[model samples]
Target chain A: MPEEVILQAQRELPDWDGQGFSLLETPFSGVKFKRLLGRTRDTLRELLKIPDHFHILFMHGGASAQFSLVPLNLLGDSKCAAYVDSGYWSRKAIHEAHRYCQVEHAAIAEDYIHTSTNTAYCHITSNETADGLQLSLALKASTPLIVDMTSDFLVRPIDFEPIGLIYAGAQKNIGPAGLTIVIVRDDLLGRAHALTPTVLNYTYQVEAGSLVNTPLTYSIYLANLVFQWIGHQGGITSMAKRSQTRSAMIYDVIDASEGFYRCDIPPDQRSRMNLCFKLPDEPLTQLFIDHAAWSGLVNLKGHVQKGGIRASLYNAMPDAGVVALADFMHRFRKQYADL
Target chain B: MPEEVILQAQRELPDWDGQGFSLLETPFSGVKFKRLLGRTRDTLRELLKIPDHFHILFMHGGASAQFSLVPLNLLGDSKCAAYVDSGYWSRKAIHEAHRYCQVEHAAIAEDYIHTSTNTAYCHITSNETADGLQLSLALKASTPLIVDMTSDFLVRPIDFEPIGLIYAGAQKNIGPAGLTIVIVRDDLLGRAHALTPTVLNYTYQVEAGSLVNTPLTYSIYLANLVFQWIGHQGGITSMAKRSQTRSAMIYDVIDASEGFYRCDIPPDQRSRMNLCFKLPDEPLTQLFIDHAAWSGLVNLKGHVQKGGIRASLYNAMPDAGVVALADFMHRFRKQYADL
Candidate 1:
């Protein structure tokens, strides 16, 4: 992610044409900013193996902003779009979509419970960050797909076809916050509602080379750096393997908890990013979190809706960090036995 | 600008928030990653005297982006806008507005010459870079007004009641090149066309306190440092005086040239920021520029539309730099006899 940002900055800096000022500085035409766009776009196309028909746009407003932007851009009329209620994050996306479009659910697994009822965009969160739910049945028969892979983007490239658009804020595995990286088919860019801001209008940014105004150059630069970092990690193939290894260590401990700890998500549909667990009850969970913080393990508190705790092992989380966390969990169970 | 970029990076730097894992190493948000917003919004707000009624939004894109944004936010189909076209920059703003609304020429001089419209909301460059045209009109006006003070924002503080909004690019007197500072009245926000991008929706940003997304933190931090510099220079009051003194010496030579040299703009309307002049015809002008380059003068070319030498004496352009140009100009005017 870091390298991706630096590369983008480098492309614009020193002025691509050897012009005295950069594209960001000069009022030149789109031709100058075009080279930088071509590089980032082509790189994503190859990495995602994106079909030739799609167009990629790096947009503003994080995923939080995207909730309104996506529905405003993609949802036409109140037609119910199919949204698989995966967890807290997916639910939030749905709540926002409801303001602009109707949503039908293909599957829902919010708190260990799973249900299916297929209906607008076959929308789903690839991995739920708050509740640690990963969708298992993904191949859809006939529906335009909109996947919110904010948590798992680039860890493994998407293979199942006919996906309409995939959007992710650049704060996670992609880059940093403030930028939502959108991969829309060329057709999707122009399908926005009439009320979208020119800056958020995928079609406008597409035509304008994202120079509608002085862009968040520094943040975009940061995201570009992250892309470079992801590429250096041998791209998505390697990212998937590392993610699996990190999740397995903690999953092993949970499976061996001997009833001292418990997890909710079904085994077939487990997440590699966020691992949520409960320590018997409220008091015990609080005590363990306290001890963990003293040990420099922080932000271990679970989402308020999901009591217990969640350990987020993102791509940047060194394998050693996960190992240490798993070891802490093991020691915590032992301490309870002593008590 | 630098702080925003740095802190935003720190927040996404994995283990940020002491989370066992951060989203940055993976993908950005919607994917559920949170990047830094910056240390404090008030740090920027307090420096600008931005009225509390208006929410401060740090936006992406440059002042050019604002060309489309201003019309979207401030003028609807029913409302007519009048622009005082003093030079090329105002004409550009008028061109962008033409796409959205009926812009009227409230006043414009013959041959794009420099003079005071001195009317309400008379949109002018305040400090023109390409032609070195500056208006000596008083800031107070009977009608609401907007000014693209891109070249000399914060160079001085006027009472500001008569001004509706002021937009400035950070490259010149403000800071670096990537950020654009827009100080608009509370009522003018969110008044744009409904179809504008949410990114360009100043109303949305003003409401969000500019944290609508990760802004160009680095460039904005640099802008903040510039504000501090202004503060150190006894605010804009002292800045206006210093610029006046520095520019007087140069303009004095041209105004009193006795046909040796010439400037298109009226002496009263001459710019203190950028000063333009010529030595009779094309031959002598080219020769003067060539000799001046060897003497350390650079970027003195005039706008292609208005051919003459232009010196941008921005806030960063020290008094010494101007004296150097003046000395070189005087020597060049005298050194060649026959030409």
Candidate 2:
């Protein structure tokens, strides 16, 4: 019940009565943005145990932007940067890295499609949204690690020491589909490539306190609101517990099914946030998507290669929403048992 | 009356009975952006007689962003780019250009306390918001010209051939903030330095139809609404007449003040949109600002200069607002005529 409190916070968001402002442009610097950002720092620090030497920056562009930025700032005399090709985003990161410095894949997780690589900065997606894989421990690499944790932020704790940098686009589980939250070490702030745009140079924003060129002010405001929501639900320990149960509930349904439904992910590699699975056939998957849509469950269509379904249980998605989805899957399975 | 009818069109802008789906984000295919952009093109073409050879782009990051971009794409491999320093913005353009190539100033209009000078690009503000100065025409630049016509858009029919590139930060006169309307010749776009970030690359944006990434969707929506608003009011010609009348009314008061007000800049170089003037001392200016705030006429304080008052009358500021300010100025002048 305490875990369900976050949904209440999300619903009561923006607090229009007191906010003196709407979720419009310019910082509701008056109240909303500052309070929420303060709450974000507090909640994140409390949950993730961020230390004095570290900083969490709210920025625009996607993880794609950081690809070039990381090398521009981090790569010194070394001409080559490195990464692991987990999915679309990692490949995208490597493509951008090539534009700045040489890029190489240290390793690639073939079976699970999770990246296993080593290089200047070993990169991987902690939770693969498309492939439905989430790694609990740090993916070991000889080089400094840069992980894209866009889908699994705050769902679990992060090890700050081994990781040189971590960037998460705030869409999948962080917040809305804009703001990017980056946690980088203090030393990494200013070592930008001389050619880097002042706007993209992390230190420029850091020195300016992220008010660099007006920002995605509203998105940060919303993200701050969401961080507060997470804190209100007893922070990350509670969130991890709830998310574990949430992931288990859906994965259990997949496991219990006698081939009536199917999930391609090996049980060990299943994601705590995204549960990607499939129906008996392509036609059945489409039908299931339509059935789910009419019932107020949307965005259920799986990725094109992995057809079936993907249910992303982010912080905002309540346990009840998961239960409702599980219940719908059950009834639909019975309805089409003949298949 | 026709003007009033067109102003009323802004109130009915959403088309969905205020539901707001009409102005949703333009998607990747840019079908929606193209349709609205097509409408904008056809309307502007009819109104301004814009040649088909020139290109229009709807982009993110306003003229401040373009100030650097225009030079990057224009200077090519040239050692020096000439500038016309007029006010706060022209100086900014010169600074941004210095990052890329050597910059030469043809004019420092404000260095002589807003006196005119000969500068290449003759980069005038057309309307300066901070100092409230608007140049009626390009100040005779022999080389290709780039103008930051942000605060005054379409005040008159511009002979685009005379201007190589015209960029506007939309918030002031065109629409809401975050969108920049860049009208550049087709040849000007493709010459960006290899290091230019694709977002800031004018050539990339124009080639891609300005739907590069998920732009500031809401800002562009507001800009399209403003373009439609201008279209309904007999296009730019009508806006020019009304705006000219508004500026003339304020200038008339300043000219008649009998030494109570000291207008800056020579009469020949005076801006029609922004009539910059100063009071005898700081106390009177502070009092005017304080009084203006109390009367709900905000943003009138002079930008951190010694001390003065600046009133920015963009397209959104109704004529009645100017009249009210003019009326206040008349009262203030008469009451303190002894000063």
Candidate 3:
């Protein structure tokens, strides 16, 4: 939520392109809106360095929908797909994929097992927001890899070659909720199961120019602006450096806290985007969350299922913001050590 | 597109409820976000007079998704469903439904016919934007009726009886693109085909609080604002009256043109939301479109298949806008008399 993007949306809300109508008022199929869509796609392709062989689709229903859609689209004649059960999101994706195909766990939680070579595709949550786990970029598989990059997309450089598809919900690093970005290799387009919902059919969406239905026009517009912001911030290279710097500050606090603060994720597997940790006890954890909130570091509470503390350091998070949180965590640990 | 609603969204964009984060930055499952969803549902329920027995779902993928979802959700063990071929949208619905079940044309375009009583349900487009056709509110059927009110929902009072489901894409009168509102009777739940996509499943959407995935948060917010705006504009009662007046002005002008313009839809079946008409020839039609654009009556060109002019007078359309279009049409016809 860059101030520039929000302000631009506000200014355009009254009349888009001086058309005496809101950008939301533009018809999804109209030339003006089509231009917006095309510009967004072009800009994103440039920023992400997406290969020409990839088809970028702007879809709805978030990554949760992609959890089901990926299997429906790629499982074609294969009855089994391999999935890495890295964390919360990966487990959810695995559960949904079971409806359409058999899901074999390639890697469960912290284990780094490989997928069976005969599987349709290997699925992985590149970064798990809730559990603070992430797959290394150098990780490879025998089967085509489908990555749920929801928490880490565009935050660093990506190698497109071992990947069949990469999908991310836009709420985190991309733009906003309600829009999902899917980058699928062109060869994977026509393999969807016949029963797949037309809206979720990648081929159908590509054919319809992502105007398969009325798209999230405003969300796409905001994403376009966010993409512009990323371009302004020196693209993924700068974002990666910033992300490492921010996450390290907080991880440094946890590592130095001895027994007072703990992060369960293996250091090598920890997510750069989300840092999850725990205090010595539940009450202390609650106190940490309240203190963080009072100090203007909100949404610091852990996801209810995995209670402790979790801080999301998304692309929009300023370096100073993380520095402040790291400082707060250090002060809290010292204050509570005597308790 | 209301200025007040847009401004409110802009103000709230930077920080919602003093949470020190953009509204878009709030977690989908967070308490604040859930409250926003609940308030929007309640406000919409109150405004639309939705009964307790009906489930109100704010979904994505727009009305086109519903074209497929209606059959996948309602057709059940019955392989046949009756659909009225009212106009462009109805035909599209029928075509999409064929992928899931056998479609019987209950009423072909230009005909009013009854569906077989044994069919799963009868479907109709309440208002056809391209052809300017609408089903009368008094129409009844032995089987339950599912209406695609994409172009006219909330523009007038609707009868609940005999209708099992009513769905509309929000871009017209409700809010913006990317969100679809589905009102389904409780009994229709749990009847979806086993192969139905989870995101489009009525039961799944309900169970997940319409959060089967990260919903179009901003779109829902805008829809909530539009709902408030509807209330401010004296509710649907006022809207219906305004719609009638605006449409009548345009229709009157067409009627008085005496061969200069023609509307093929039967007068009684003509849509109050979309008024489609043709001039004497293609050149005249093109001239009319060019002239309309010059007069600031944009998006007046009809659907390519229809090849004429279409003026959409949705609920948000001011009576003055329609009057101006009518005035422009009158003057255009006078200038082009020699042609």
Candidate 4:
């Protein structure tokens, strides 16, 4: 979603790297496609510092698909899995896992979250986009820790030492929406249930080198561009710092408003990717959103279920945009506080 | 894949339709995205002449994913489904369906293909890409006819009266690889298995208007462009005629080669989309492919399982390409006849 990435993609749209054809026109086995696949995998590995024991797979169907695939692939003879009830996405994962195996709702605050020795894995939605909550607690689980880092994947550096698998939908911090990145430990490859579809089978995908079927070729190409852009922008450490600065700018305005605006999330649990807040009344909230749109700051509406305002500050959001939003929030609060 | 379509896409890559955001940057619920979704669905319906009783749902994953979903969504209370084993892709669909329900292999040549009154559906892969075989028979089935029209979709007009559902991966004729289009009858919406993943559930997807989870934003946008392009190119009627003319130009050389070239598929079953043929020997076949590549005709190598040359003439292929290929084939045959 970076401007440089989008520009590069547009420039190479008609003909990719002078290959005489677009990326979609070339066969997956061709040189251009092979280079794309290899470079994307390598770049992701270099960026994430993923262990050699882990296989990075480019898959389809986004994070929602992984809700079923995680339980199917990891529930090898185990009858149950432990899941942390973080928020919206975590509840969706737990609900989907119930269709495959027993889901034990556990909290990450526990000293050792794994309830039984035979539990399949410990799952958590590391960042909940809907509720603007993120997990910052150190996971103390004995079983494999599976994290859905959909909204906050590359916003910060990851420590793969305590992780078994990580899946992220690429719309937020990575690239686009159609592709899902699954980094799974090699040892957990062939544990899929018999009824698992081959497209969702981890072992088959790894064996086929993630070319089990024609992949989301365009998304992967753009994602590689994004990864390169990230590397150029000083990698995940820089992205994390920017995220903190951007979210704090908006959160500071809410904290200083003195009942003019409010954010209910605890400071420890607030998501740096998506910051949700509310104004005093529905009419004032509407006015704030309308005024923001008039000032060329769009898509500030919150998730419909929550119904207030959300400022999603992904990696692509420039710092100037956040500064503008903070400025707008201050002016809007001054105008509405006297009402 | 059309040059005009690609150029249009490239032109609008940075900012789509003056919305000041790329297609991937817009939220699914936003006005730009909703317009895209509606226009795409409408254009496809107009092109395919899809009935009012059918709901056109844009989905994730490709044809291979649908091999499992078709059965999962339509199996209902029926324990058996009839599948026609034509070739590679059909066998794949049949194999995947076996994991879910009882698969009854029935040929289209049968007078009444459905063996039981309670059979869920009759499935078929309309065109076999690997072997250049296609089903030309008018199917007679008491049950709903579910067709995997992945390769041949939009190449010809379809009769929807006898069909219950049709699904196609959009890469072939529609757009890119990540999005699949599922057109299901209104009556078959709620028949998915209890454990079916929500992403694969037809009822859930329809109710959510294919925004169930992001819905492959970029592919849908490109697919809309392709639909408009198809409309400009005189719709499916023009595509079918061009397919015949283009394939006949290649197949004529094979038939006239006497013993120098051979296409094993029966004349009636030979596909108009993919035309496969073999040279006298492996060396000659290798020479032909290399020469064709040098002449700027690439990707003529056949499937590895079926080692020969396959000329896949999709909708995007210009007639000039076929003319060049036919001319090259004639010259190559004249030169290699002495060998």
Second chain TM-score per prediction? 0.81, 0.85, 0.94, 0.98
Q: Largest DockQ belongs to which candidate?
A: 4
- Model 1, A140-181: lDDT tens digits are 535567778888887776864657788886666755455668
Which parts of model 2 have CA positions greater than 4 angstroms off?
A1-49, A108-120, A137-143, A171-178, A304-308, A318-320, B1-58, B72-75, B107-125, B137-144, B154-158, B162-165, B173-177, B181-184, B232-234, B268-275
lDDT for model 3 comes to 0.85
* Residue B4 displacement in candidate 4 (angstroms): 0.5
Q: What's the residue-level lDDT of A103 in candidate 3?
A: 82
The C-alpha lDDT values of all candidates are: 0.66, 0.66, 0.85, 0.88
lDDT of 4 at B196: 78
- The alpha-carbon deviation from the true structure for residue B210 of candidate 1, after best TM-score superposition, in angstroms, is 3.9
Candidate 2 lDDT over residue span A171-200, tens digit each: 555544446788877876667766665656
Residue B166 of model 2, lDDT score: 81
User: Per the 3 Å backbone cut-off, how many clashing residue pairs does candidate 2 have?
Assistant: 5
| Docking quality class, candidate 3 | medium
Error of 4 at A22 (Å): 0.7
What TM-score would every model get versus the actual structure?
A: 0.74, 0.81, 0.97, 0.97
lDDT of 4 by residue, B207-268 (tens): 99898787888899899998899899999899989999899989999999997889999998
Q: Which candidate comes out best when scored by lDDT?
A: 4
Winner by TM-score between candidate 3 and candidate 1: 3
Q: How does chain A of every candidate compare to the true chain A by TM-score?
A: 0.84, 0.85, 0.96, 0.97
